[model samples]
Target: MTDAFYDSHCRVQAEKMNDLAVSDPKQLVALSEQRYEAQIRNVCSYICNNMERSHIVLLAGPSASGKTTTAHKFRKMLKEEFYVNSYVVSLDDFYIDQCRLPTLPDGSKDLETVYALDIDCIHQCFDQLTNTRRASLPTFDFHTASRSIITNDITLGDHEILIVEGIHALNPLITEGLDASKFFRLFISVKGEYSLNNEVVLTHEDLRFIRRCVRDYYHRDSSLERTTGMWASVRAGEKKYISPYKCYANLTIDSLILYEPCIFHHFLCPLIEQMDPKCDIYPRFERLYHILQYFAEFDRHYVSEDSLLREFID
Candidate 1:
């Protein structure tokens, strides 16, 4: 279940728990990492036990919810421990061309909707993989916002599974008419909120925003303005396309790392200090910066190489 505390009880809980700044950061960091890995191991064990019934794992999450990292790690653990060959199939690669996409009310491309994907192509891929244990997949280029002609062909041997990761992974359209018994679905996100002085201080939404800001700046060449400007739409898309289907998931994973707020705070504080305050999104960052100050910073070097935090920070 998603750990949440509100009111006076929540504040007392956060105050008692948020003591890493005064404690040994190194020891606490190791313990925190272990806790997260423990959850992954348990999930893998469950999936392996049910291998006879399910070969396809659908992983769905909202923006900046660490879906990509969890999907890869889940596949990695399955192979390393159980010797189950699992392949991660990114639904992002199946997106149709941007020009042909359906538009929203403001004339902007509705890229978040499941309709943006080629439904027929997905069915074809599933058929091929289930029957022949091989499928040639299309590659979508984000820079061009179009599907590349180049194909990625993948083959699965006996005892292998395909893990599909995307916002629409849990949508019924993706699995309609298919045998529901053949799939295991997971929904992951940061579901916990931080409280201070009996009031909510930091929320999962704020945490995700900070993550996207840092990720886009470092990897996507996007400015703070660009990411913040689109924050509303990203959230709206999550509620409309992602959250409603969360109930369809067989399991939900709380992707929150207790020490992650500090890691993000350390990097994001310095980075946002350089942005233009006059920008519309500056106020949001200001609010985040305030809430972040209550938490202690964690050293990035101590973060393990396989840490999911590596997906965004490094």
Candidate 2:
């Protein structure tokens, strides 16, 4: 879909969120739950209808687009609806060794590029899984920035599905020789924004940025400063590799939860407060903090532990 389509969709959803926040605050949790369940059911239906012919499912999206959680949820729903087995293979586990990664003009490792991964090995694994229904997959240790010595032996059972998720999963290079009909492609992203007093307070990318910052700090032990520093490179990689292949997806999911910003405020406020005023990203942090002022704080208790929002917060 075009940017205009998503912009309109986000606008309507933002308005709905505002109305719900004012009219029935207690129902926000239920509304969010229903919306999430509907999307899961929609994906499950697509898989059920196509299960006979599709063997591989490629789910790609930008950073912090809820890809991992979506894959897990889709797998759960598929098992419930069809009683079939599925394996989720993370492309992240195939990252090339740090020393061998391509260097950018500024001498920084360009980890976001598809070439940062071992494409030949990935192609072979895909071939093995599809033909022999089994393959040995490498596991990457993000902390050490190297591939682990141990590999996972993944096997697909009869009538099973193989889900490969990563930022570049839909890139043509990953499935070059595979039949297009044997694959189901999905592109998931946050496509909504919140407006206040007729002024746009946040954009779709802003929501994703917030998610990334929180997730990086809490889960990856990355500082906000480091996360902010890497964002430009991340967006550049998305533009070069991910965005161009979006049209190849058979389905697109907007992974935004309307109450996300409110929930994020609790975690981000303290982090933003800790930033030094003179730091390069302090101004950006201040702006984000200001935006949160327009949103009401949401109680974490209202959110289910399994919610996609949990992928980033708590």
Candidate 3:
């Protein structure tokens, strides 16, 4: 069953923010921070309650959904509030060697498929971690598009939590041999949108796309055009592989930061404006630009370095 907490929380938050005076950007930023912090605290409370019975956490989210940042924040909350340490295992590191990965008809690696991961190795590592509290974690080299020879030795403390996060963490194939009782599953995504006059102005997908575009431009050296071009494939992969398993999560997190669109406007507008008129992605760029016009710009300086927005906005 899908957890109703996040959906309810989003509805309440939207109402609260909408009721606020839109005249002051400072007030909006403060309110956004308050909502974001409360949501984080709620997630931490849920984790603490399950700490005694669950040692493993499987955190799954779609692209630009702030999975990495959420993992970091969860770790921080565990340390500060519960006095527990945690180990993070990235599923991206468990990808099968490039040569063995499944290829699309176009001869490109179909990296989105869960079969691209080395299932046997993951099961073995999880077995070692649960049985002996020790495991060697493999690291994937994105540049080389393969698993690296070097590995990190991780030993989980008696009170420590182990978090495994990726786009496919909730996939049955990855958790095939694992004990469901030993783990807590979480599904996160941007589940809110900006609306005006009963019309949806910006959708959750558009928000995530903005995040991905900003992050891709600065961190991955991907141009706005390239990010927009790849969006269809990303959404297709999510529909086929990710969305079906969302309801399996013990909890769901809405990763939307209400003030994000305003912040994104500062970073994304230039890139959107630069899109070639003749390019196929120009229409999407135009649509996003038009939607952004409804939001009042907020200063990014108010956002902390550790904020979830950092995962996408650099």
Residue 263 of model 1: what lDDT?
Answer: 86
Whole-model lDDT values for every prediction = 0.82, 0.84, 0.80
**Pairs that collide, model 2:** none
- How many clashes show up per model? 0, 0, 0
- Model 1 spans with C-alpha error above 4 angstroms: 1-14
Candidate that would win on lDDT: 2
lDDT of 2 by residue, 1-314 (tens): 11221244346234546556656656776666667778878977888788777778999999999999999988888888768778888999999999999999989888889999999999898888777888999999988999998899987777788888999999999988866677899999987777765557889899999999999999989999899989999999999999999999999988887778778888898898888999889999999998886777767777877899989977
- Stronger candidate by lDDT (1 vs 2): 2
- Across 1-314, the per-residue lDDT of candidate 3 in tens digits comes to 11221243333233334334256656666666666667767877887787777778899999999998888888888889878898777899999889999988889878788888888988888888777888998999988988898997888877888989999998887768777677788999998876665456778888898999999998999988788778888998999889999988988988887778778888888877877889877888898887776666667786767778988877
TM-score per prediction, in order, is 0.92, 0.92, 0.91
Per-residue error for 303 in candidate 2, Å, reads 1.1
Candidate with better lDDT, 2 vs 3 = 2
lDDT of 1 by residue, 94-146 (tens): 89999989999999998888999998898788777766778998999988999
TM-score of 2: 0.92
**Residue 256 in model 2: shift from native, Å?**
0.2
